[model samples]
Target: ILNFKNLEYFNMDFCTAFSNSFLQMSELMASLKYLSLSNSYLNGTILDQGLCELVYLQEVNIDRNNLSGSLPWCLANLTYLRLLDVSFNQLTENISSSPLMNLTYIEELWLSNNHFQISISLEPFFNHSKLKFFDGDIYAEIETSHSSLTPKFQLTSISLFGHGDSGIFPKFLYHQHDLEYVDLSHLNLTREFPNWLLEKNKKLKRLSLVNISLFGPFPLPIHCHKNLRVLDVSNNKLQGHIPIEIGEVLPNLVVLNVATNAFNGSIPSSFGNTWPWGCFYLEYLVLSNNSLQGQLFSKEFNLTKLKRLNLDGNHFIGDIPKTLSNCSALQGLYISDNNISGNIPTRLGNLSFLDAIMMPNNRLEGPIPSAFCQLRHLEILDLSRNNISGSLPSCSSPFNIRRVHLSKNMLQGPLLGDLSYNRLNSNIPDWMNRLPQLRYLILANNGLEGEMPLQLCWLNKLQLVDLSHNNLSGQIPHCLYNISFNYREDNHDLFDQDPQILYQLPQLQILYTNYHNHKYLTNFTTKQRLYTYEVQPLHSMSGLDLSCNKLIGEIPLQIGELSRIHTLNLSHNNLTGESPVTFSHMKQVESLDLSYNNLNGKIPPRLIELNALAVFSVAFNNLSGKTPDRVAQFGTFEEDSYEGNPFLCGQPLLKSCNENGP
Candidate 1:
């Protein structure tokens, strides 16, 4: 293709093989009017000279490449250039003072996500009268002040996130009337809600004001424009109740998120109200971390196309509505930490598209829904801290269940039986080994009996295993260290979302809850204290907790091999043995509790170098020794952390080390 001098259009986007050889092509394809090499694996500094020779080029997109260095000063020579997109590259240093200003024909310019160190003025950009899309920073200077400025272009889209100081809204926006899309996110703009921008740019289709300092009640206009598709005001300082006419006014809205705000009061029943057209086309509605209370069973919320509805961290009270089954297209429903009561609706299983059902920390009760087993695509099921009774649902079908949390619940008996939910009092079920995709399984504080199942060793993807406070009695399985996700370096495929579920949903967010990268939240019992971890922190965490159980045996030395393990608790058991010096091999362990055991040995001195150790306790043990040297995290421990062992002595403790004792 290099021989063809007539090549006018060259597109190699996402082509990893296309490298610096593209720079030489300019000699042959001088007539090239369009060139897009985005996401290509091109390395080294972007060529400063070659691109200018292609004077006929109208559009050039080389974004998301490894190209670095400052903006090419020669770019201004390409007066015929209509569009230029060099975003998401490693380009560093200051831009040329008058860069691309002479390109009067330029209509679109995207220079975001680069390390342009110097501040730029909007005066030069004013020369490009045809500008329709400008995303780079354009801080106003004395010459470009709004009162005297007269912009020649009418921008349809403007994105200025993390671009400039949080002064008043760019006053130049007052000159433009055709704006359709605007993103002022992550800017400390202390303006009052930017309702004036909404009033002026009525054609705005997408408005994002995330993490801004906007104050005062959200000014939701009574009459919403028909084209307003998305409105994200999350992570702001906004207060006051959400307008009651939100659903009725923003009828065409698709994504409405006001999460992490101070808004209080019950969610208006009008929130569930529909437009005159009968159905709502809304897809993602997130109102988490607000003070919104009251029942969720409003007649207005008949969103059939809804995918993700997150109403967590609120004070909402009332029964989990059975009418929620009407949301036939629902995928991820997170209503945890609310005062909602009532039994798990069996009808929820009918939504074959459902991926997660997180209803933890609620007042809901009754047996686990056996119909939930029918959801072949279910990835997460968290019903912990509730009064949910009965045993786990018995189903022989292969599943995609990765995380199941029934801890702190009233669930009783062994998880064994067929689909009929009949009692089969026995040991841990052998069928648990069949679910190879299982990563986190927590059933702590339940009354499960029988020896720790050896079949659980077959879970190759197991990362977090907790069976604490149970009636189980047996030596811990030694093969537990072989779970692939923890032991293997190439277990990336294990934690990934099921390929079948991904193929079925196709969209990046199946139900608008982006949990593909997020692991299920799990509580860790380290140092005799419970700590809750959400998704982000769970990715790097691996743990094993079998404390407060009746198991009687020596601690498995093989547990030391789990180098990726972050928390390991085996306290309150009747184990008898010397602490494995091999335990020092756990380099990444953050919290380790081996207290309340009949073990007899000196605390491993090698453990002192465990730099990541934040919590370490071995109280109530038969151990006797001078505590490990108090350095780093060791200096922060209290005397109670090493109490109940009268023989052990240290600096923080009242008892001192014996003279000349090793």
Candidate 2:
């Protein structure tokens, strides 16, 4: 293609096989104005003298590659270049002395996620009057410079993420009046909220000053910036009541996240008010982890376009506003860790787009409304730590439901189940067979009784099963081996890796990308201690705990088929017979406990093959003869692992194998 003398544009983005030789040939195309090799796996130092020969080059993009070493100094020769993107690479160079200082005509520069250290002040680009878009990082401390050195350019979008202390705001931004997007997150700027930025930039649309240590009450902009859409001041020390007219001031906001701040007082009623043009355009509103008090909303509350409302970790009182149902487009409602009281409104079922309803650790009461069954898109429903009573509605089933946490409630009777820490008194219900997508079955700490049901075996995707501390009895269900305890590792499409469960709005895409890091969590007893597992660990974990139960009978040999299980606990039961020799096939078993049982006969010497075993115990069993050979993980076991097995002799135990005549 380089042979074509007049080739003005050449694009090979996403062409991973493209070689560095292409860069060497680019100098031949003297008329080339635009060249893009993004994500083309181009590595090594960029050819210093190759592309610089194309004096007519106006744009260059080499982003998302493995290109290392300092940027070519010859880039300064391309005076006509207007846009240059070398982001997401291994480029390491100081921004002050870099060739970018000579790109006086450059309008757009993208240098994010690189090892480029920036100077305390942005004096290098002061002469680049045409620069409008600059997105880079500050990897070193930025000293507060009192010198009144202003730049000639007014950037429309500037994003500078600081890794070290940026003692104050970038003084250059003070003179920028045409600013549209500004993100100076993680800077640790110890100054008060810079309200002057808003007062100056009338065209600003998105401003994210997250974790910058900005204190003092957030002063609202005096003038209504109609173009403003997103305002994220979260993870700061901003205190005092949030300006009540905030909604009226920024009516077109698509996202307003003020979470993890010291803000107090009630939410501005104007947030839910309709403007003369139409309903409020606000879609994602987050006010969690603040000292905010008072009722959630007033009588006129109606934000029709609101999608995700998070009012959790606050002192907010009063019932959840019934008018919340008016948000027909709502998807997630998080009001957990609050003082809110009253029954969940059945009207919430009207939100057809609702997917998550997390209201744990609140003063909610009354039975869960049966109308919730109407929500077909619902994925998460957490109402734990409430006074909700009565039998669970039989029709409580959403086709896409993935997590249900109704624990610590006054609920009774058979459950359609994941209801742990409740007062339910019944046999493991057969209705559970209908939940073919069940991944976690946590019915622990309840009055559940009866034999381990055969229907549980139908849940082929089961990963964790905790029936410990219950009245459950009868032989361990041999059919449980039919369930694939290891589901997540093999099924990539079962659950999305992205924890952001809510739908992404196009407008707030960049501003609200990291709004929440949601993770699936559950508590289970393992290694004689209760532990909470979440996210990646939870997905890779597979365990079964039937300890502290009335279960009696020979250990099911079929259970040895669960070779991928991480934990297996049948301790504190009346189990009999020799430990299964087939357990040697448990290649991934981390914790295995068969203690406090009537199991007899020689210990399975083949069990020594479990290299991943971390917590192993056959203590208090009536087993006799020498223990498994002390090697691999078995060598790490102490005397406690074989304490109560009086007839069992091993290296770890006080008794010798010779004394037991092994």
Candidate 3:
């Protein structure tokens, strides 16, 4: 209100909107030093006429708004401005000649995620002696002026992401000694590693130079800086062995990611050793997609604080070290695509906090350790593409389990399994009735032969059922529609006390900041094409694939009750009777395949109402009648969709319905 002439701070952040009189009222509060309207739905070229007139303003934050146009030249009147955050807006301007050049007293500036054309050269801000933080755009480019000017300010944090090849690193960084955080990721530097940056900034806490086209060996700082906590140099061309004395150099590191590089040689043993006075605090160690070889771990290794360890896509060999069991805080373990051979270390069960175990495409053998049942918090278990054999052990504790991938193995026996692409020749496990929380049952490409068990209907939570490419046969269960393939109910409350839930624990968040980015993928054939579905998409997907099986019976009309189902494939079966007219209720059906069957009678013309249908095929059947009307999605259907059914005639077919006497 204009009556509050002494108002020093006015914050409307997160508000729906500001009244028309609010701006006029704000202008009267000449003593206002702080004004924050971030995410307040303010539009147009910002309130430059009113806010910029407040010459005594010290801080202005209008981020996350739809404000557009160039930075107002009137902003130069606020000579005492100490902070300016215009990030996440549609504003466009050139930083070289903007009003920002006059705000010499500015201490912090945020211009990220905008259309600001920023020059890679830092000479524009050389006069801001008090500038402590500078965040710029990802589209910054090198300036034509190749001046080697030194800045007067000593920034504690500076981030400038560039597009394409930006020539070389900014020479002005050479004069900075007070920097604590620096990120030049995705800049396409195409230059050698800047080891000198580390040598100069002794107090640096976090350094990220990812995907910057950095080449040559990664040399460490000669002097140890205990303050440094995170170092990410992933997705580069850096080669050579990691420094052996890294543990002594940066002893307090919480994250060390060097994945997707050309680095060769075994992991340095120094990583296992503790500091002279205290233990190493390392938590995340990622070295995937490299040429590193040799045994994974040494006997004397002792990294008790370790959580997630990724060594995938490498040449590493030897048994998984039993010493890994000592990492009681461990959660995720990824060692796939390697030459590692031997039984899975049973001692891994000692890690009670473990959640995900990815070890596919390896030479592992033997049955899954029964000790794994101790992991009550486990969510994902993937051991596909191995020599694992014997029956699946049952101990029952991981009630939170969601996904299981044990395909491509020699495992055999009647047990609760995801034993697809294996040598399992027994009947589909009836014991599956006991697991009430089961969601995905993938047993395709196996020798399992038997009648469809009625017990499957009891698993109401089931979302995806894949039994294709097997010897299974029986009548289609009418009760199959009882399964609610709807979106999974939120079960996060079950793991409320678990530290593996990143958001619940602040300490674990620091260690698993990238944990949510990890995807849980599975292969499913749909519309004659195999698709790999990731976690988010797979959650919304509901399909039943029983093609390439020996199933026989009439198509169940009750299946149409599954209105949310996205895919339904029952082709290559001995099904009889007319196509279910109730199929028109499947509003979400994308791929419907009942081809290669002995069905007869008129094709349900009501099926044309399925607007969401992208793939439709009833070909190679003994049906007769005109095809569904050539309209909507059916208009895109070709002759192959109606071929092999000689009596069937429509626009897509060469034979006319009049001539065929449909």
Q: Rate the local accuracy (lDDT) of all candidates.
A: 0.73, 0.82, 0.82
The Cα error of candidate 2 at residue 13, in Å, is 1.9
TM-score sort, best first? 2, 3, 1
Residue lDDT tens for model 1, 1-662: 67868888989898876467766668788788998998887777666437777888999998878787776777778888999998778777644364665777799988777775423334456666899997754333122344466678888988775644656666667777788888777666776787666677778888878776778898776566667777888777788888776766667887788888889887766556667432277778888878888887675557778888888888988887777887888888898888889888898988777888888789999988888878887877777677888877766655676566665666666652111112324567777887876766666655567898888988877777777777789888899778743633344342164211322343645333223323345666765578776655656668888888887878888877787788889889988887878788888888898888887878878887778888888889888888878888888878866888877887788888778762
Tens digit of per-residue lDDT, candidate 2, span 1-662: 74688899889899965467666676568789999988888888876427677889999998888988998888889899999999889999888888999999899999988999875467788899999999888886676566777898989988888898888787788788999988888889988988889899999988888888999998887877688877888889999998888877888888888989999989887787778332289888888889999999988887888888888889999898899989999989888889889998999989988888889889999988888878888878888788888877777444587778887888987774367788877799775777888888888888989998899999898899988888988999999898889887453431233211122336322223333434445688776788877646778789999998999988888989899899999999899888888899999998999888898998888888889989998889887898778899989999888878778886887777774284
Candidate that would win on TM-score? 2
Question: Candidate 3: which pairs clash?
Answer: none
Q: How close is candidate 1 to the true structure, as a TM-score?
A: 0.83
Candidate ranking (lDDT, best to worst): 2, 3, 1
List residue ranges in candidate 3 displaced over 4 A: 1-3, 17-21, 138-140, 277-279, 414-418, 424-440, 447-463, 471-474, 477-521, 529-542, 550-553, 561-566, 587-590, 596-598, 608-622, 626-662
Model 2 clashing-pair count: 0
* Candidate 3 whole-model C-alpha lDDT, 0 to 1: 0.82
What TM-scores do the predictions have?
A: 0.83, 0.91, 0.88
Q: Count the backbone clashes (under 3 Å) in each candidate.
A: 3, 0, 0
**Residue 419, candidate 1: how far off, in angstroms?**
21
